[model samples]
Target chain A: MAEINLTINTQLAREILTGFIQSEITRVGFSRAVVGLSGGIDSALSCVLAAQALGPENVLAVRMPYKASSRDSLDHAQLLIDQLGVQSKTIEVTDMVEPLIQLDPDMSKVRKGNLMARARMIVLYDQSEAFKGLVVGTSNKTEILLGYSTMFGDSASAINPIGDLYKTQVRQLSRALNIPAPIVDKPPSADLWAGQTDEDELGFTYEEADKLLYLLVDQRYMPQEAIEAGFDERFVNTVVARVRRFQFKRMLPPIAKISNRTIGYDFLYLRDWGT
Target chain B: MRLQLALAQINTKLGDVQANLDKHLGLIDKAKKQKTDLLVFPELSLTGYVLQDLVSYVAHRPTEEDPVFKPLLAASHDLDLVVGFVDEDSRHRFFIASAYLSGGKVLHVHHKVYLPTYGLFDEGRFFAWGDSVKAFDTRFGRMGMLICEDFWHASPPYLLWLDGADIMLFSSASPGRGLGDNEKLESARWVERINMAYASMFTSFVAHANRVGYEDGLHFWGGTTVFDPNGEELAHGPYNEEALTYAELDLNQLRRTRARLPLLRDERTGLVRSELDRILSRG
Candidate 1:
């Protein structure tokens, strides 16, 4: 089995990401950023980077906890907020999301999880306007590639600092950035329901997925080539299928090409146009 | 001859010609104060890179009449200058070009020959490919200029070396990509290797100026550098930050290096020409 090396220069990654956060945010005329703190390593990393880029006073960390969210999640988030000395707010979304969840008592776990994720997005964006800041996203490359995030939910943001880093790389950077060990060491979860974990639900660990995806996506290996490289056939097939299925989530909404110069087609201009 | 060269590793505003021109003037003023004999700016220093639709609007012809070039040319009287901009032809075709200015006149302009179309770059769709690669005489000596992707290929620099250019000035708006195991980004490592190799192999001085800052999602790592004929690094700008790095080049070293290792004196131009002709004809 050919081992895929996922090790990165954490110091270089830190500089690039922090510069990315600072430049991307300030270029759009905002000196502040609002990050949704999920108490996970991804959010913790993003929040720390935002604090580093724009000073801690300019970053507003919003904690949107559902009724069934774990107590450890809240405490971990508070621990980071205190450690980083950024402005903190805890917005309980029980009132906002419960009314919707009660309408269909038999809602699936996926749907309920999506509701909670989007509820957090809403709070962060609203605080962004009030705080005059941009919403910094926390979705890592693994979740983005696997389509694990809900569209316009946790995936919605003005800028994403850690989106390029995979889940394993996120862990590596979290430790490098001196994030609290409890946040970095905890089992990954969406906290959609009581006692729910991400790896168990996905049926494969992130360690396994990251190595295969790095080959398939980064190295541009074929499915057969990935299997030849010692990834399980079933695992390779499932990851490939998920990546293809979620292609729409990665792109902007398709615009119809009726005019001579359409927005994404002929009227091509960078987002940094006229900045 | 000895020359003090300055690499202006600056961050340019996107699509703002006036603002960028002001920055160039400010830096030129600072370089003049330092008595730099030659000041170099990065690719598209007047107009930022990633100018997809803004290319035509930001393009300028390197003439005294041009609003952007007027001051830049006037500043050349104190010291020689190398600035990058989108050059517009009479036929209205835009080319990524670098102009050498001295004594209040444009000395030479080298249009970028390679338009990178694949991956994150879309230069082919927006601009015309340059067809010529020639070296021109300067007060310091004969020199050649190449844009970002131009030096990536072996032929442009090779042609300049053959054309009696002792100094190679390279500029880029290169983005930082591929995080490696080292402190330097992958792009920086590869570029430095190429610059050093060109200096040693061609036995000429090599200077590179790259921009710093982000436009849209792309982050241009600064790390401007200069290498002597002996392949020793003379000066290096900061990685991912704006800096005006200076390197003093003793042009006498080129004569010394070439005399020690007469790579150019052992001529194989006829052999290379015949082989190239045969290969092309066979194809």
Candidate 2:
């Protein structure tokens, strides 16, 4: 089997990512960032980058936890906050999510998790207004491609600093940035429900998933070609199916073409676009 | 005399003239600190490459009084600068051009002689080609400028050499192409070979400054470099990254090479011109 090497120069990555954050934020007439610290490697990496880009004083790391959340989650997040010397705030979503959870006598684990995700976003957005900072996102490319995040919830953000990085790349950067080893080594999880892990839900490991996805997406391999590339046919099809099904999550809501210049169609105006 | 040359390999955003000018100033400051005699920037360093329809919007005349370029002029008072930009003449005819600047004034402006139209390049569609190639005297020596495609043709460099150019600067925005056996990118390798041959044949110093960064899937390979009169690689910058590469040239070396070979002195220019005229008369 051909080996897929996705190694990156972490130092260059750090410099470019930090420079991108600083320039992008400053260009939009703001200099502050509010990142949701979920105690995961992705969010931890983003928080450290934000702190470095906009001074530690300007970055606000908000930790939103639920009732059934792991104790290690808050402790791990606090370790990063103290290490980076950025401002931190803790908000419990148990009260905000209870009324919605009560709307259904028997809410499924997925619905409850979605509710928690949206509740966290609400808190972050509120804090953004109060803190006068943009909300930097934490979703990595792997989860984003598979639609593992909730739309209008964790997926909504002003800008994302690490969205282009895959899950394994995030772990590599986390280790390079001196993230707490315990946090970096821990099994990946969203902490949405009691005892729920990401690999358990996805039925695959991130390392294997990253290689397969890199070939399928970046190398532009067909399903048969990917299967020949050592990926099981079923696994390849499942991942490809998920990526295709979740394409809507990657873009803004499609606007119907009523006129020649629809909002996102012919009239493409990015933040940097000018007359 | 020893001349210090700095190649400012930068990443320029498309259609952002003011921002690119700001980036140039920052690099110029670094070059000044290095005590560089001449600083070279990439092709379209001010407005960037890959402007399909936005070309006209960013095109500006190269003049000292232009308000947008005032700071660049002030920065050039201390060091000579070779920078690329969209050149619009007084008649509103736009061309891909490189300007040689020193002491708050433009010494010479060379419009690109060749407008590549094949494959990924569509320069012929947007720009009018330049009519002439000439070398002008500078503080360093007799210098000439060429935008990216101009250097690809053999005749342009030969014309400059015949015009008594001691140093030829080629500003480029070459996209990264094929990969080699060692897994390293070999996109700019072809250009490097051509540059080496040009310097060796003309016995003149050759410097190339290329931009880095991705623009709409086109990744520019930034292997900026300088080759001495004998085709020796003096200084080179990293590929796929922004950097400032510097090299020191000994003007006496060119004179020594010319004295030993004297190839320029034996050129049959009169015979070639007469044969060309005879052929044209027959037609």
Candidate 3:
């Protein structure tokens, strides 16, 4: 782990994923892959890569629809199954999740959202146990950056193929892979609540917002420059505000810097421990 | 010749090569307007750092006629340009690098030797570590170039000094969050102290340029600065602005100071590398 000399790129990424699958399968003695297909581009691209890297017979796509999920989402889930020809099943969360919600109907939206995300993960893991497969991830770089997705829910995965692709890039890759163009272009959502869309909840479009983000956050433009660059002053302020506000989600839990090289402090890099 | 240098602290989008090129071009025009002698930019200024796989496209040493180097060539017909980029090498693995251009010819290209991979950085993933330590004879002086993290390591700078570098340039894309007001000030002091140590040791003018922007969720806290041979701050840019600052460097002052101090003349280069290598190996 000492000074690994180089870092992440596409070739290294592919090699790492391919090598990881090979090693994980041999080391853990698991041969199949299971994924929660949300009829979203992230999961679709994951299945395509997993089925190709692993085998189609070895990949299982689980369509876990909730009570509030759009009917078209379910139909699109079927479209992905037909397009990829991977083994899949319809696991309605109505029976499972509703019981917990009924038991705790007074839970806040944040708690409920976390519960739904973890619930989907539980379903994926159970299916993995039933099918003896690894749970492939559907989270992409865009969601990961904003900390928009649930931590243990959609955030946890055995391995993530699309986690590196931006949401727009995911759509691009989806089209190239011949995934349903509608699903690729469709507005993203977790379908955790009724009439929910990611943008509506995020309060900004990914394309426009990411461009502004690239300016304010990435370009180190002061709030003034971002506002001057034709970005909505209010939107720029809000996004920049949120980005600074949630820097914690991107970092490890805060630790007391008691030691010379403390975790989350000076020992941020593995080089501290490496030769 | 005393050259006016503009450290164009640019914001580059990952994978948008043409757009990044245009941005660099715009900044070049800005530098051109300033009538700068050298338009220096941050490391990987053309393409934002923390890219996933696009470096593979830049992995090959495209012929000198490649379209990528066109803008810097045209940016100023006569002004010297020092820009940082991902240059493809023979192995098809890119290198973290700085290219100096003037008179329509790339004068010198310095590839980074230390590829940092731990923590949030993954420089080791895309770049092949460069082994050569060279001091290119520029029109200004015998200048040595280092990429980000190179100055942090001792080997390259010691080698550069031994190779007779009269001036050194380090380019960086350092990410910092706005959360740390206390820690930020402390780290800036640390950088200043470290660079001061380098300046004092080498007794040469040191120029450090860091990008000011965010990319892939990482923010570059640019406090680009220069120092005289006596560890004296010559000029420092604002912490978070895309700015250009110049310092009057009297090479004769450094020469007289070094001669009076007799530090460089008495350097013991013979035993340094071997001893350091032994210590590194033991660790």
Candidate 4:
């Protein structure tokens, strides 16, 4: 039962994240950001940070709700938009995903959910061009580690402000940033269907997942060591398996080495190369 | 005698040598206006820190004939300067190096001895390791220069102290990482603590100049600081921003502090040399 201290100084985190968003975006000659505000804590925290980095007017918070999305989601998103005074746009993604979803009658709910998530990505990228802003990501570390996110769907973005934060830390930062109570306090969900909560689907609370993942990932604990530290052996194995299985989603597609200077193999340069 | 020192905490453009050189010239001009006796910039200030493949493209020789050093040498006619750059040897091997220019002459050049190879650092892959650690004479007295990771180990600064360096100039492109309940970043707190410890242990002035900016994803926190021989912080730059922080070091304090502490006088170099020789021979 070795407890991991995942607590961060909210003020310091806020400064670093805001500075990160601003520097990453502007260094590439972008003055604005487009964030998919899902009315969840992760996206809300990201949107707040983007608005703080690039001014409120510079942040374009897009709400792309599917037909099955709860009214609370839309309302909570609107609450943040109004509070931050940032520009907002609503694009209903029902028409976009429904046609493809109807193509295969036996399409699993998981497939349907991924389609919806990706449909939002298309809309956000399109708006990024029209609005002259980069796409800001909202995927938190807890879900990212557990392979809970759809690759290139909710995960694709030009810059991510909170990708390193755990879901619990996201909630902590949201509260510190004075995010609306309903958004911060509500159960986490992807809202791909009528009633879908993230924890209920994942079979574990974010607090439990975050604590375990912190030990296994950040602290670099072995699975056997984690089990000895009071985490259930089955839980440790399951989490480790998920992390291992989803490793591909965390990185760029590997390129085969052919030449003496192969991109990503031997020809290495930072993304800020020559800037 | 007092030394007017300026820590030019700046954000360098990655791989753009000309742009960064222009920045250095501008900072030198400003430091001259302030009557600063010496100005120190962060490690790789002339070329950004995260240069993976761009290392050779931006490497320069610190000579009067070198294009990059020509203007910097001309600027040094007014005020002394400590600038970091990628130094290319005659054999074309590159190094993470810093040069001390005074009176229109390159006084000393220190290639970073310890190229941090693991955990977010790839200096070993790109640059050749520097072999020597020697202090040189300046108008202010004897001074030593160490790049980012060089001062992290105890030996570099210890060697500088033994070589009669009364002032230690440390430059870093130190990225900010690890946050805790403390207000300061984990990297920042540790660096400041070590700098102060070095100053107190060696009874010498220690000035650290760390850059600020985000390159790729790494953020270089800029809390450049100066500590007197008594380990008291004299000046501190703002965190995560660019600024030219200044501190007036009363060089006489080195003599006064050493008079009371007497650690330098009591140092046993012969005993340490014999012990190190014995340990090496056993291996």
Candidate 5:
């Protein structure tokens, strides 16, 4: 009889990152972590993990909020920085963005969104270059599952601590870590558009959607059976449909199988060779 | 007699064992009505592979306890069937097994080895690798099973062939790649090329069953196909989507080809010995 292998638990996640960071630091002799603290749960969790992995002084939280973003969002960002006792700064995106919008007011929402996401990423990357740190990602499995994240935008991060866990699970873990309550309870939003909520734009609440999806795709429940088991039929079908609809968001750009060794499906990329 | 067998490349979501079983039954009925010799399916088709860590549990429903097997057993009575699912025994570790059914009974089960444990794929974290490599007694002579990565390596099935595996079937859930124009893709051309080379070298028949359709971020490439002893592509399924391509295999050709090639006959037993090196190197 063989024993079951262990997974990456919270303790393990932290331990894995700690060891990885220390080895990387020693290998290069020194390294830091730069995080974009959106005052959101994802970024907050990332910041906390980054602080523990690298020293709080070594962890830099850059808050890049736009002018249209509410004052409460900024306050919440400060609240987290003050509570965590990490080095923080405000790099408001208003000045950087106003010129871009003025240049192309007729540009589509997608174009604007892409610009906004890229702008934040550019700031984080620039800061990371200045401080010689890695950009830690804050995306949860739910966003990654639904292809809800922008590639190279918020989606671009060096190492994601909470990428596998769902949004609800992220909140649960955040509570376990003693993060501020307001951030946990706050309605999740990209703060992408004014008066926008993650749930509203996504057409369902994170709690409602991620669970049903977890059951259907992750748990392998069929449409009728999932509904019989107390999931909304429409919601279950819709979420399953969307996951099928947007399969591209989670994968690397497809390289045709012209050669024998392609990128993902065939070609092997073995980790831990030097180790 | 030549047999035109179709390997049903269907989608199996994680944990929805019942739905996958239903799909199996439906495909079996279709195959039986078409008068096909057999219909093969992907590994873990009953309970979807990549069940996070839940697949690590070594628990299986017995013939009586497993309601999912009921329809499958009934369907197999009408048609020769090969399917994949979770099977458990004394090994506390779970097994990715392929089941061969006939006359309403599961005749044999081949547990998978070479469980992948890297990147997005994590089979080793769950099931214990299969140790045995014996070919089963089939109506079509001695046949063996290699689930997914088992066909990737040279050791396991090569040993099975030495143990009288004239026919080799690989049940897989090979992930799909998408083109820029938004279409499902069948990839891992390298795996097929190398696998076919071994089959041709060994003078054996090889049939590969890959699951089709999308599940979450992963897409199952339905490139089911069969290769003759000469490594010719006898039949190939549609890329990135579902299609049950059928091929007629003449078992008599297997013996005649082995005689013609004489590679298997002319092999030296002592030189390039695999097992002896392992024992000697362990010291």
Candidate 6:
């Protein structure tokens, strides 16, 4: 009750994020960033921020499309690329993934989507090497908490700028940054299959999810607290369960502690790894 | 007299003295515009907490003769200020110290008495421990100053109370910690409660200023606040945000509470001294 509303100053957030990106990149001896732009608000915001931090000349926005992907996805991504004047590339993943799909022959849609997601990461890491840039993440906190992202796929990146912003806050910052109205207003989708939208698959709107997530995660509310706060009992249970279940995705691979100095247990930092 | 006090809870970059000094000046000006009598900042506000080995780089003598603190001296000409900094004494030894300044001169300096070395704090590694706690006369009556960890001990506040100090200012850089069943930061909650308890027990006004923002993964929760003599909050800043919260302290409330409770009227120092002597002799 003592804490105030979960509102952030957009101007301050922008400055801090841009500075974080610049510092993290230069710290690891990198000067540029490569972002996988999906024409979604999250990716668009990341691309714009990276362009602002490292300059448009140093940002490379890659758009990886599937066979059934929407043409609007590409067009919307192009809108950002053109507006920002950053480098861009469109890579078709149908050929790369077709062999894996053929090997399974009757692969489910879920498997096929996961394949496409990881395929995009492959191209991203490859571009990171070719362009001498680090892969910047675009996963918002909502998707991350809900386990809505593909692991080792869209989630794999050297650093993430918008990972802490909730889906609603991401939209809020997108508006503040003047991202194209079409991209911001469009229904969220992963473009894995025809007519595939995020909320439709998740069975809830982002506004509903973000509010619930803010209370559950950022505020560290228990289920009863959320229930008292007017969140639906079933919805809170489901989201909280999903967050617990997907907690593994948020952490690195756990190592078995056998030695006095295991990698992650006691000997954690780089300096601890004996020079 | 009603004293207008402003607690400037700000985010400071580690070891960035020049930038941090500018931040202090900016907040000082803002407080002056509001006609505040006293402005207090967080512990080591001129050099952010978690300096590690950078303490040497940022440590500077806080005197008008020192160029680093010249601007702050000028800014304190109108408003009385309590600013924390790394103090290098005549012997060139560094101590975590807070200066009480008014009319462009450093009035009194309170070196941090308790150097917290456990857990995340390693102040003993860098700062020399202060040996005493004292109160001094200010325009707003006698007041005492304590650094972050000094509040955790009962002796400091008790000594100040015995010295007849009416107001106590505590500057802190406490990191945000675990959440209780109430779903709020337990550390911040405890800090507020203990501050109220101290204010009520000692029958004095209590004002605490804490820093906010992330530094090397440790996040300082800024819940800067002021409490009246009766343990009621006068002003509370939002948690984890940069703010300059203000409150008017009525010293008459302290007198009224003291008259009602009369706890400090009884003499107990002789008993305390005898018990301490006996305990130490057994050791």
Report the C-alpha lDDT of model 2 over B1-283, residue by residue, as the tens digit: 9998999899887788988888999999999999998999999999888775667888887787786567777888989898889988878888888988899988999999999998778788778888999999998789888888888889899889889898999999987644323334455768888999998888889999999865643567788889988888988898767899988988898888888877778878898789989998996
lDDT of 4 by residue, B120-189 (tens): 8888999999999999999999999999899999999999999999999999999998877789998999
Clashes of 3: 17
Model 3 bad stretches (over 4 Å): A1-275, B58-63, B177-187, B271-283
Off by over 4 Å in 6: A1-7, A268-275, B1-283
Sliding window of 10 residues with minimal summed lDDT for model 3 chain A: A1-10
Q: Write the per-residue lDDT of candidate 4 for residues A157-244, one digit (tens) a residue.
A: 9988898898888988899999999999999999999889999998899999999998888888899988989999888888899999
lDDT of 6 by residue, B1-283 (tens): 7899999999886677888888999999999999999999999898888775666777888788887678888888889999989987788788899999888888889999999998767789778888889999988899999987899898899899898788999999997654323434667888888899989888789999999865643567788988888888999997767999999998899879888888778749888889989999996
Top lDDT prediction, candidate number? 4
Q: Looking at model 4 chain A, report the run of 10 residues with the lowest lDDT sum.
A: A257-266
By DockQ, who's the top model here? 4
Point out where model 5 deviates above 4 Å: A1-275, B56-59, B62-65, B177-187, B270-282
lDDT of 6 at B20: 84
Clashing pairs in 1: none
Better of 4 and 6 by DockQ: 4
- The global Cα lDDT (0 to 1) of model 3 is 0.72
Better by TM-score, candidate 4 or 3: 4
| Higher-scoring candidate on lDDT, 3 or 4 | 4
- Global lDDT of model 4: 0.94
The DockQ score of candidate 4 comes to 0.89
What TM-scores do the predictions have?
0.99, 0.75, 0.53, 0.99, 0.52, 0.61
lDDT of 6 by residue, A1-275 (tens): 32334455576567657766775676567999999999889999999999998999999999999888999999999999999999999999899999999998889999999999999999999999999999999999899999998999999998888888888778888888889999999999988998999999999998888888877776778889988888889988988888999999999899988888776664423210110
Off by over 4 Å in 1: none
lDDT of 3 at A205: 84
